[model samples]
Every structure is written in C-alpha cells, then in structure tokens.
Target chain A: MSAQGQELQRQGLERPGLQLQAQVARSDFVLDVHIAQPRGRVLAIVGPNGSGKSSLLQVVAGLVSSAQGIVVVDGDTWMNEDTFTSAEKRSVGMVFQDYLLFPHLSVQENISFGLRSRGSSRAHARATTADWLGRFGIAHLAERKPRQLSGGQSQRVALARALVTQPAVLLLDEPLAALDAQTRVSVRAEMRSHLSQFCGVTLLVTHDPIEAMVLADDICVLDQGSVVQCGTVADVTRHPATEYVAKLMGLNLVSGIATAGTVALDSGGQLVTTNSDLTGAVLATLRPSAIAVHRQPPQSSARNAWEGVIRDMEHLGDRVRLDMEARPSVVVDVTSQSVVELGLQPGQQVWLSVKATEIDVFKAHDEA
Target chain B: MTTAATRSPRRSRRSKPPWVLAIPAIIALAFLLIPLAGLLMATPWTSVGELLIDPVTQQALRLSLATSLLAAGCALILGVPLAWVLARVQFPGRPLVRALVLLPLVLPPVVGGTALLTALGRRGIVGAPLESLFGITLPFTPAAVVIAETFVALPFLVLSVEGALRAMDTRYEEAAVTLGASRMRVFWRITVPLMAPAVVAGTTLAWARALGEFGATITFAGNFPGRTQTVPLAVYTLLETNREAAIALSVVLLAVCVLVLVILREQWLRPGALRS
Candidate 1:
C-alpha cells in the first residue's frame, strides 16, 4: 500500500473498492442508497422507470450536488462531508443514455475532447484518440460526425471516448438501451468483451434483465429510491426479493408462512414445496416454464394444482406465455405447438400444476 | 403515386391561405417593398459612380464600416458572456439585470445617447473622475460612435444568444464534465459550438443595427464631416445641399441592408440551420 492508502487506513477509511453512501432529496423523490463493490467488478443497477437508478449513478459521478454522500474509489475519497469534488475534478467517466457526443466535432475530436480539455498537447491528444479509434474498430470513421454514424457506431464512439480517459470509476447509463434489437445483440457482445478488459470499477444502470445478467457480475435491484436486493446473478435470479424483482426475473413469487413441507400463501392459496426444513415467513418462487397447463385436471404425480382462467396470451417466438388468473395469479409458458393443440385462448378455463420440487422456497427478509 | 396522394392535402392547405390573412399580409408586403422600389427608381443611376467616388462619400462610408464593425466585435466579446450568465446562472436580481440590458433595444436612440452622456460625458458623473484620472474625453469622437452603436446593438446579440443558450441541450456540457473537461472548456468547446448559428445571427443583426444608427450618433457623437459623419448622418446632411448624392447614398444603404437580409435568409434564419 502507498502512503496515502496507509493514511486512509489510519483514518479507518481504507477500502480496496468503491464505497458510496448517498442521500438525495428532491421535491418529488428521494434516493438513498449505500453500495460497495470490489475493484474491477461491474455492478449493474437494475430498476423500473423512475426508480432512481440513474440518480444513483449521477450522485456517484459528482453530477448531483444536492446529494449528501461519501464516494470513495480505490482508497481515494472523491466526496465527503467537508470535501466535495466536482465532476470535472474526479477521475470518473460517464456515457449518457442518449450518447451525448459533441455533435459539432468529428469522431476523432470527440474522442480526444477529454484529453484536450485536461491540458494534453494537441499532438498527444490526437495520437491517443487515434489509438482509441483503431482499438474500437472505428478508424475509418474518424472524420465522420455523430449524426452520420449508426446507433451502434455512435455507442462505440461514446464508449471509446469515455474509456480513453482511463478513469478510475466508469459510469454507463443504459449503455445498450438505445440500440435496436439486431444492433443490441452484436453491441452487447462487444460491450461484454470491453467490460471484461476494463480494470476500473464500473456501475452500469439498466432496466433490462438480460443486460444485467450478461454484463454485470452482481446486481442491485432498486425500487422507489431504495435497494430491494443486491446479490450475485445466480442468487438474485434464483431468489428474487420483491414482486418487481420477481417479475423482472420472470418468476411467480408468493409470500407465505412455511411449516414442514407446506406453505400457506397470503394470496388465498397453499403451496407445497420440497424444502422440509423451512419454517416461518418465506417466499416461494415458481418459474413460469415449470408450470404445466392442461385442458382438464391433471392426474399425474404433480403435487400442487389449481384451476385458472386464461386472462391473456402472448407469443414469445417459439413459446407462448399465458397469464393465468388463479387464486394466486401466475404466468405459465408452454410450447406454441401445445397451445395450438389445446386451442388456448383468452377467457378459456385451464388447469395449472407444478411439481413440488420445482418450487424454490427461501426465507423472506424480516422487514419484508 | 402514393407519395403524391399523401402530399396533396398538405399542398392544398398551403396553397390556400385564409383571405383575411392573405389580404393584410399582401398589403404589409407591398407597404414594406414600395419604398425600396421608389428608392431604386428615383436614384440618379448615371451619376451614381461619380457621387460614390466623392471624398465625402468615401470618408462617410469608411467611417461607418469601421465603427459598425468595431461595435459588432465589441458586442460579440461582451454580449455572449452576458447571455451565458443570464441563461445559466441563478442570482438575485438577474431578471432585472436582463431587463436593463434589453432596455436600449426599445428606448429611443436619442434617449440612449443622452443616458450615455450622463455617465461618460466630460461634465457628467463618472466622466469627472475619468478626466481627472485619465485625461480622457469620450463624447463627439469616433470612440463615442462605437460606444453608442454597441450600447444600442448589444441587446440584439444578447437576446438571440440567450434564447439559443436556453434551447441548447445542457447534457452535452454535463457529459464533457464527466469526461474531465472543466467548466471553461465545456463553455468554449461544447456550449459555444452548439450555439454557433445563433451567435452568427445575433452578430449580423447587431452589425446591421449599428450600421443604420442615426439618432444616437447625431446626439452623442456630433456630426463633423469626415471625422464623425457616418453614411446615415451624411445622407441627412447632403439631402438639403446635394439631393443627388443623398439619393445615391440612400441607394447604397438600401443595397447593404438588402444584402444583410439575404445573407440572414440563406444562412441563419432557416429552420434547419439552427438545429444540429
């Protein structure tokens, strides 16, 4: 450790990662969150619209002055009660949602803007910018303006512009949300590779679960200005904490009281799970694909069964998702061939059944 | 065929403006154009070259161009920062300051000259200390002409630039800052480039306004031939003694104003030109 790191440790503030505790109050919303992630890890902040996910990123980047927080990155304090570094002074880089590239500048000038503004010589800035342009496979586009570039090309330019500064903390807000579906797939793969090579701590704010799952190492679920859950991808995907997270993960979550092998669901239903040791308050998550739909009551070995009305049906490429209105409403996915065979339509009555072993049960948070 | 069918309604809608509006609009157009037509018709075209080469005409034209250009340059330097402050900063009494800055636009030019006199004249408030301290006299000089022109023309630049600054997307500046660009860098490299079209439009308007200034120049900077006399003041003076020269100068002023409007129409006034 360096002398500064030792001094930080002496002050009980040394941490080899990003530590942020922020509270921002507005007229209509208040965002309060505390997050810590190790260096070189990409933490994805996932939330619905107006969930303060972007506000958290802005606070960490020193763009929100009304926020009261302590942001320390790799043992360097960027913000504290007495010391508040502005965005320009902090070693941070951000790619905005719309990719706000300077429209007046060419791609080369746009990429070199950070270095030039920080007092780099013209030749030095040009050399570094050219290196980044070549690295991003956009060397031929160096003379083109932003408007002339495609959405995917613009995103790459924005990423290269942000990365060329070699910032200690990189903030990307909806990095791939602006691309079309066809472009998103290819760009997402490229983004994953670039993020894997990045040595800085990254905070990616996105609403898409697939983006989080494919890009980030851990996920932070935010709802209404508060973090509902924060954990690894596998843990959060297998066990979501709130209805929002459950819906985002495509699971039917139910609150219940567990005893032995049975759960008395709060939504006027009973669920039998294979977790025999679980007791007290718990959440049972059932994957949509795990539930089987039938025209008549199943006589098979499936344990839990319920009668439901098909409220709506949506086609998902090769599969069909049915919104079943049962005692505890749930979503079920079946093959399109099965849907055609059964002739499933809205307002049709059906039987839904799932195996006890397929239902994952876990203890709910005490406050929840 | 589909394109024509889809565009027919819009074409018909444009072809038939309401009669109530069309009548008054045509009348207004004729009302503005008739005088320009009369000026071109009444000018002594055969003697125009001789009159334009006269030493008095040359001096007045040179002085007018020099003063107006200097005034526009000064307005560009001072007014853009003022506009930036009005559009970006949040300070007490800013609205009042903006109103005061725009006061010269509506105030009579003679009244503006009088106001400038009270502040900068030799016998006036600050002028007394200025003379005692620096041995300077501002009134009835070429410097006074530029000052008066800048005073009356600055608001034109400020209003347009401030409007453009307000309409600009500040996200670009924020993005620059996050990329480690300082506030000054962002202003020069991002905000200014983004608002370039408006700046050009505003500077042109201010230059044209300064070029045509008569009441203020006559009042503050006394009309002395070849020294303080601009084209407009010279035209006023020559109308009594040399009617043909006055007509030729009026034609020159008319041609310059028309050229300014044409350039504005082609470049900055178009809808698409202002946008990125």
Candidate 2:
C-alpha cells in the first residue's frame, strides 16, 4: 500500500465514522465539543472529574439528547435538535466502568442477548455466542453466572457481549477504572488489543493518563465540559492546552499571585517570575525535574530558592522524589545518583531551587 | 505476637453481648416461629388424609390452585411492567402511584373485595355500562375468583419485582440499549432475565396468598362448592360443620405450606445459588 493508503487503513475508514458537535450548558459547566473519529480509529477522551466526558458519550449513544447540535455517524443523523433517535435505535455499544453484566445470565447468555434481539434463531445466537466466547478465551466460562467470574473474566465477557452485535461504534466509559491497580494494568492492555483488532470506531474515556497514552490513537482533553485539546498522544503529552491537562500529564503547575511579577505556589508562598508584563494570578507549570534540591543554601543565579526539610521521599523507577516542606512544600525530582550524592531521606534538611525562567505562567480563569 | 495480643483484647470485648440486644432478638424469633409451630401441632393428623381426599375438599383445592395460578400468571404479565415503570421511569404522581399499588395489600381483604365488587359488579358504575354494552356480569363466577385473587396477590409480585428493578444496576440496560437493542428488547432480554429469581419468588408468594384467599373470594365469588370455595373457605365451612374435619383440612394446608417453604429455601434462599 502507498503511504496515504496505509494511513487511511490505519484510521480504518472504509466508511466515514462519527462526527459530533454539540453544546449543553449546566449551572456551573458548559459542554462544548466538536470531534470526529475515522471509521475504526480509537479516540480516547481524557479529563478530570466533571469534564462532561460521560455526557458526550451519552449524547452520541442517544441516551441523552443534546440541548443543541448534531450527532452524525456513518452519514446517519442519530441526534439533532430537530430529530432525536432513542438509544435503542442507535447501533452503538457501550462498556461501562462497572461492566454491568446481567447477574442472572450466564456468560454465553449475556453475549447472545443482543444477537437474539436481531431476529437471529436461538441456535444461531448460540453459535455466534460460542464463536465470540472462544475468540475472547471465555468459552470455558460460558455456563457460569456473572457473580462467579473474576473481575478480569467478567470484563472480557462484557467486552464480548458488547462486540457480539457488531455495532458500528463502541463507547467505553472508564472501562478500567473499577479494577485494582494490578488488574487494571493487565485488563487495560487486553482491552487495548481487542479495541485495536476490532473494525469499528471506538471512543474510550478515562482520567488515567497511562490508559489514554497506551490505548488511544488520538486523545481529546476535556476540561470543565469543554474540549481543551485534541491531538495524537505525542502532541498532547508534548503540549497541553489547559492547566488541568498539564497537571494530569504530571506537570507541576503554579499561578501568578498578582501584578507583582510573583507566581503563587498552589499550596502557599510565591516565586518571583522573569515575566514582568504578566499580571493577575496566572497558571504556572514546570516539570518536577526542573526543580533541584540542595543540602545547604547554595549560591545560585536561579533566583528562586527556599530552605526546608525533606518531608518525604518516594522511589519512582530510577529516580527518587523528595517532598520538601519549604515555603510551599514543593516536590523535587532527582536521579538516584543525586539522592546518594545529597544523602536525601525523609526528615533530612534540604534547600530547594528552581530557575525563575523555567516557570510558564498563563492567566487563570476566575470562573469555570 | 503483637497483632494477636491486640486482636484478642478487642475480640474479648466484642464477644461480650448486652442483654438488651439479645432480649429483642429472642422475643422476635419466638413471636414469629410460635404461631407456625402451633399450627403444625394443632393439626388433626389422624383424619388429615381422609379430609384431604374428600370430594369437596379436593374440588376446593383444585379451584384454589387454578385461580391462584391464573392470578399469579396475570400478575406476572401486568405487575412486571408496573414495576419497570415505577422503578425506571419518572412522571408526575409517581410516588403516589407506587403507594396506590400497595393499597390492596394493606387494606382489609373484605374492603378489597367490596372495592372490586363495586368496580366490576353487575350494578357497579363501570360494570353497569359493561353489562349493558356487552351483556356480561362478572360477579360470582370463576372469572370473579381470578379477579379477586389478582386483587389480593398482585401487590406482592409488584413490590418484589419493583424492589429488584430498583436494586438492579441500570447500566446493564443502558449497555444493552447502546448495543442496538430497543428498549423492549433490553427489558425482555436483559432486565427481566436478571430479575428472574425475584420474579419467581414473588410469583410463588403471590400464588400462596391467592391459594389461601378467603375473605375476598367469599365476598366476591361466594362460597359456591366448585366455583369459589378455595382451601381457606373450605376449612371455614368444615369448621362450622365438623371440628375434626376442619382440623384435618388445616393439616393438609399446613403440609402444602411446608412444601412451598422448603422449595423456596432450596431454590431462592440458599446462598450462592445461581438465579439464572
């Protein structure tokens, strides 16, 4: 295949997929988004709490009608202000965070439920269920009730049940959020594999950065019901459009205190900034690595430094994290080499320093 | 050693029970179980078989079974929908409607029978028109038997199924809905199947209530030998004529109740039993 053809195939757009542009207002939040996924590509929506991610999914699936705007999938209008199709009429599949398996149905029965609705014969539904169960490696669990299955097994069954109907689009709402940390790692990987192999557009929503980075071909960052950023994983990681996204992606953010050229730490204290023209309390963010820890008050031209004690220390891979209870109790990241060099330990005294220019400040919104 | 010492000290204090807590539980158990035991002990065992085999008794038993079963079946058909509407949908007077469904359950059975008679009897406000238009009278017939039993038993099924529906995770229905299944399909294929155990349990309880129906059946359908006299009515009539026969009939009813209870225990009450 040519490069363009390869790219098109990767997007899985044998037919055009969904295009949704809608706005719904709450007393305190406004949901504004315009997004489209190529026929079979996976679009991951990432956001903090109250970001309207689930509402967007509900609108597209026709569970909730949008106050205004359109939801078109594969050239069919599922939801428009003038026309609203019920959720039942939409060929969309959802995998809820809790799995939502029918407690009374066996694994096989759950998988065959949607198939049976499509006028398929019992035997045919059973056959389809058997095929799906086998494909998902849940055939052995076919006769067991949902309550009997482990979390991972039930998750696979739920996925198989959603996929058995061959829906045109799939929506997964924080699919791995209910699992334990250990189970989430494996289940997320398995779900990612299943999603990638399936030939349908999938939209996965999560607040977990690792899940979005691993599973989504493209990421849409929603903040307080609005799309703050939309791009590939690399683009979102390299350049976040909102303070929430920056914090979610593990950036240490602070905001300017006022016109005094000093940015206030989120906890307390203030840092003199290099940007003299920036007024108001602006959001400031920096990588943890950008801040360095010193055992004693070190003479440095960096200009921003505070003396404090190491409140805590945690091991993250090859690095050691030091929580310094300085003016603002800032977290400083350093190599194990530096930990050994500075003899860093919890309760050890330390001084923290950061370059004034390393801080990036932007105006913070007073209202959501 | 430290964990064990700390746990045992806490366990010792926890194991000591208050007389105040034990008194109510003991009284509650006795209050519930004593009547059942008395019913069993007072049964005239010697004549029980003969009383059960009497033609009149047999007829009453059969009528009771047929009417109660029919009523329970009807309740299943209508009550499930009522439950779904009450549990899942929002509308004006929803709370009032839910309370109204339980009206028959809490109202005296005689009042319920009277209510049914006034609503559907030959000279009833609506029934008068129905009678004039269709030349049909619904009182004192087998149909009346079914209606009376349904009136008394439907609330049981509705309450049980409604509780199950309310407790159910609605996300499953949403999942099925998004899977291209219509609302009706989701109800039948997902919601109903998930609630099968509660439905079955409710049906059995409703059937039992209908079988023992006395006041409503006697008032609405009358104590006709084969048409309306259920087990409870038969026992009442025999009590007037023959005390031993009445006691024997009670034993038979007791045996059936015990059998139903056993079935319930095995099928619905057992821990870890699969509902599907």
Candidate 3:
C-alpha cells in the first residue's frame, strides 16, 4: 500500500468504508434508505422502475440537496443535518445513465476537463488525460467529438473521463444500459475488469439481474423507494424476499408454513422439500427449469406433482416456458422439441412435477 | 416496392396546393418586395460610386460600423449573464424580471431613448451624480450613440441566449459537477461552449439591430454629422436635400440587411442543421 493508503487504513480501523442513511422526499415519492459497505466493495442497487435506485445513488453523490441524512465515505462526513456538501466539493465520480459526455469537446479535452477545472497545469492535465486514454484503450479516438463515436465508444470515454479524476467513490447508474446487446456484452466485461482494478467504493444502479450478479459483491433490492432486502449476491439470489426479486432471479416463489418435510403453500398446495428442520412460516423457491411438465399423470419418484391447465406459453429461444394454473401456480420450462412433441398450447391440461430436493426453503420474514 | 417507388412521384405531383392560399401568398410577397424594387430602380447607378465616397457618407458609414460593433460587444458582455440568471436561477418574480428585460423589444425606439435620457442624460436622475462625481456629460456624443444602440439591441441578444440556455440538456452540467468542477468552472468550460451557436446568433442579431437604429440615436445623441449619425440617420438627413445620395445610402442599408439574412440562413436555417 502507498503512504496515503496506509493512512486511510489507519483511519479506517475505527470507521471503515461508507455509511449512508438518507431520506429524500419529493412531491409524490419518498426515498428512505440505509446502506453500509466496507472499503473496496461494489454494491448493486437493483429494482424496478421508479423504485428509487437512481435516486439513492444521486443522494450519495450529493446531486440531490433535499436529501436529509448522514453520508460518510472513508471516515469523512459528506452530508449531515447541519452540513450538506455540494457535489463539486465532494470527491465523487459518477457515470450518468446516458453517458453524458460533453458534446462540443474532443475526447481528450473531455477527459482532462476535471483536472483543468481543479487548477492543474495544462501540460500535467494533458499527460494525465493521455494516460487514461491509453489505459482505456481509446487513444485513437482522442481527437473525435462525442457525436462521431458509437455507443460503446462513448461509454468508454465517459468511464475514462470519470475515472481520470481518481475520486474516492465511483457511482455508475446503468452504465451498460445504453449499448446494444452485442456491444453491451463486450463493454460489460471491460467494465468489470476496470471496476475490479479501481480501489474505491462503487455503487452500481441497474435493473438487470445478470449485471448485478456479475458485477456486484453485494445486492440491495429496492421496492417503492424502500430497501426490500440487502445481502450477498449468492444469498439474495438463492433466497429472495419478494415476488419481484424471485421473478427477477428467474425462480418460482411460493409462501407457506412448513411442518416436517412438507410445506402447506399459501396458494393452496403442498410442497415437499428436503429441508426437514424448518418449522412455522417459510418461503420456498424452485427454478423453472427444474420443474418437469407431463401430458399424463405419471408414477414418477418425484415428491410433488400437480395437474393444471396451461395459462400461457412463451417461446424463449431454445426453450418454451409454460405458466401453469395449478393449486399453487408455477412456471415450467421445457425444451422446444418436447414442446413440439407434446403440442403444448394455452388451455391444455398438463401435469407438473418437481423433486423434493429441487425446492429451496428458507424462513420467511415480514413482506417488503 | 418498385411499383410504389414509381407511383410516388405522380402522386405528389397530383397534390397541388390550394389557390386560396397561393393567391394571398403571392400578394403578400409583392407587397413586401415592391418597395425594395422601387428603391433599386430609383438609384442613380452611374454616380453611386461618387455618392458613396462623399465625406458625409464616408463619415456616417465609419461611425455606424464602429458604434454598432462596440454596442454588440457591450450587449454580449451584459446580456449573457442576465440570460443565464433568467434561464437557470429560480428566484422570485423571475417572470416579471424577464418581462422587463424584453420590454424594449416592443417599446418604440424613440421611447427607449426617452427612458435612457431620464436615467442617463445630464442633469437627469443618475446622470446628475455622474456629472458631479466624474465630470462627464453623456448627451449628444458618440458614446451616447453606443449607449442608445445598446439599449434597443440588448433585448434581441438576451431573448435568444435565454431560450438556448433553457433548451440545453442540464445532465452535462450535473456530470461536470460530479467530476469535481465548480459551478463557475462548469459555466465557463461546459455551459458557454455548449451554447456557442446561440451566442453567435444573438450577437449577430444585436449588431444588426444596432446598425439600423435611427430614432433612438437622433433623440438621445442628436444628429451630429460624422459623430452621432448612423447610416439610417444619414439617409433621413439626406432625404430632403440630396435625394440621389439618400437613395444610394438606402440601397447600401438594404444590401446589408440582405447579407445578415444570408448569414443567418446559412448558420441556422439550413434544412437539417444541428445547433450544438
């Protein structure tokens, strides 16, 4: 570690990383959140539209002055009741959702804007900007204006511009959401590598679960401007707190009460799971691909089976997803060949079976 | 696709515009153009060179160019910050302030000069103190001409710049602030550069309006040849005694107005021009 890093570590022994507790009240919506993350960790805020994910990021970056609460980053107080630092005074770097690069400036000029604004000498700023351009692998685009660049190139330039300042906190709001699918894949991988190398606190706001899973160390789920669940990515994906999260994670969630190895589903069905130690209230989730669909009732060794008419059928690339309206509604995914052989269609009666080991059960908490 | 492509031209040709609209449009065009045609016809084209080089004509053109350019400079310096405040700041009674800034656009130029006289004339409200404190007199001078021109031309620049500022995307400014740029730095490095086209358009408009100012100059500065008289005032003065010189000067002013229009069209009125 460098001397500054060592000094930060010494100061962080008492108060590490980031602690933010803020409430921003607009006319129609209110965002109240409390988040804490250790240094050198990435926290992904995932939620549906209008769930205050971006609002929370803005509050932390000091872009919203109406936010009332405390924000501490690396043992420094950025906002509180009596003192609210403006965004310009705070050491923060943010990539806005649209990659709002300066349209009139060349790529090199845009990257060096922050350094020049902070009173650095022109030669020093130019050298630093050149280093960032080389690091981001966009040195050839240094002379081009923003309009001449593609979406992926713009994203790279925006990232290079934000990171060239070397702020303590890096906030990315849907950084890859603007690119096309093919470009997004490559840019996302590049972003992951860069983010891994950054020695700072990162807060990523995205609605894509795959992005959150691949990029974030921890997941924070928000719904209706409030935190629904906060845990490690594995913990949150394995056991979701709400139906939204379960659907986002591509799982079928059923709420019920457990006794022994059986769970009395609240939606009027019984699910047998391998978690025999669970008692009282619990939430059980099973992957759609794990559930097998049958045209006729079979004497299979599966622990649970139910008969229902197919409510809807959706084609998803190589597989077809069927929504079955059974005692406890469930989604089942089957191969397209199987779908063709069985001639599955809406209103067709089908049998769904899942082995007991496929159902993951956990204790239920208060609803989000 | 081939049939549709072949049929499109005939289909468009068959859709002729209504005679009701075309007849009045032609009449309106003639009504606006006939006076310019008459002026071109009445000019003594053979002696136009001699008339243009006359002492009075030369003096008026020089003073007009110098004062109008100076007035444009003054407008740019004062109007841009006023426009920024009007567009970005959210103080109370902002609409009222904006209305007051734009009042000179609709008020008569002579009335604007009268207003300037009350406020800035010698022995006037603020002018009395200026004279006693600084030993300066502003009425009937070249400086008074510039002051008068700026008073009438300022509204054009302010209105144009304010509209552009409001239409600009503020996300770039927010991004700059997050990148550790102070508000002043952002204004200079980002906002000013982004609104460059509007600033250019506004300054040109102010310069043109200042060049054509006549009533305000005569009322506030008094028509002193070579000192306070601009092209428009020169044409008015020569109209009674020297009709041919007056016609020649009017033609020059007409040519300048056409040139301004051409420049504006090239910069902003192109079919698919992108301002920023």
The local distance difference test score of each candidate is 0.86, 0.78, 0.85
Winner on lDDT between 1 and 3 is 1
- Model 1, span A260-357: residue lDDT tens: 98999998889888989878877677888999998999998999999999987776567677877896688787889999999999999999999999
Give the TM-scores of the predictions, in the order they appear: 0.78, 0.73, 0.78
Candidates sorted by lDDT, best first: 1, 3, 2
Off by over 4 Å in 2: A1-15, A83-91, A112-135, A164-167, A251-368, B1-17, B20-28, B119-122, B127-142, B266-276
Candidate scoring better on lDDT of 1 and 2: 1
State in Å the error of residue A250, model 2: 1.7
Local accuracy of candidate 3 as per-residue lDDT tens digits, B9-43: 87876786668887999999999999999999999
Clashing pairs in 1: none
lDDT of 2 by residue, B136-185 (tens): 89889988999999999999888878887777778877877776677677
Per residue, candidate 2 scores C-alpha lDDT tens digits across A28-111 of 878889887877688999988777888888888887764666777776777664578888778877888888888877888888
- Higher DockQ: candidate 1 or 3? 1
Query: Candidate 3 at residue A350, lDDT?
Result: 88
lDDT tens digits, residue span B35-114, model 1 = 98988999999999999999999999999999999999999999999998999999999999999999998999999989
Off by over 4 Å in 1: A1-15, A118-124, A251-368, B1-14, B132-135, B271-276
